[model samples]
Target: MAMLNPMPYEFLGVRHKPNLNNFFGFIYAKVTVPSSVKVPVLPWKDPETEDTIYPRGFFTGHYFSEELKAVEKLGYKVECYIGYEFSQQSLFNEYVNHFYEAKSKAKERWNFEFLTKEEAANKMFYTYAHEVVELNENHLILVSDTTPSRELLEAQDTDSVFVQNPLPQDIVGSGLGQFKDELK
Candidate 1:
């Protein structure tokens, strides 16, 4: 949940600062600002002529979606600001607190019921995630000695590996993608 927070501009598609070169984040919108209208000096405004340069191009790094909505009401075509809205601080804080409480109180371990050896092997082969358990940033415990190998699949189709948490019980979570220990 912390990683999914939009603070990391590149990862969550929400840039903290304005960027005009590329629409890497969801902050920028492609609009057509008219020359007839009187507006403030924006980033895309022409320095000498004081006119809108990119009439039908992206203008980025300045205004929020609410301000852009006002522009849309002025007969301008604005795209990519409808569904996205910046979350209120209190709402975001409540969401974070809920997840924190859930994680802190969770006492169950990850149950790999109905997981086949082949599926486990494939996940390991692609993501290098051992038994789908992320231990820490730099260290992860490999669940099986012979997983991701053809020998495990050929042995039994129903066969699967079990993961035992070697770390302290206080460091475990009951949900998927939760930390197995201190996230450092």
Candidate 2:
């Protein structure tokens, strides 16, 4: 799909550096495996304008801690991404079919709503980027042949975070603690 507003290619902090082929694997690994949350959207009615507002998406976070406490505790690496539900009936049927075939069956299937990679990236960029205050290096980065596999668990270590998984329990408690407080 064409970029809606120009790919925020430089938004990721690590994108500024040179020779990132090695990092691409790391980033892809992070994407293939994520620990995320099902954030609820509460509809709000404007008091004066009386306009209805629909909640867009849920907040999500990785399982790793600043001290790598969670990763160490869980004995693996973890990361997360956000997902949004949007209307896409205008899209071509063949595109929809192809998307369905490519996507996993973990999320609720809505005939008129679907999630896209661009939406996922925007969600993560807005919700979790500022929350990443630190990084830990104690963990070893490993390579897997099936790194692009759809099975979240198989593609990522138990410590890895994901946007969506067949099992919700894997990422129930990885929300942004301080960041959530800030939002409140």
Best by TM-score: 1
Write the residue-wise lDDT of candidate 1 on 48-157 in tens digits: 78776534444543445545555767655555542322332333556666765565455234332333477567556646643555476434225343354333232322
Q: Relative to the true structure, how large is the alpha-carbon lDDT of every model? A: 0.45, 0.32
Q: TM-score, each model?
A: 0.24, 0.15
Q: For residues 17-67, could you state the per-residue lDDT of candidate 2 as single tens digits?
A: 223212221121121112332221223355679776532332223211222
The CA lDDT at 78 in model 2 is 28
What pairs collide in candidate 1? Answer: 18-61
lDDT of 2 at 178: 13
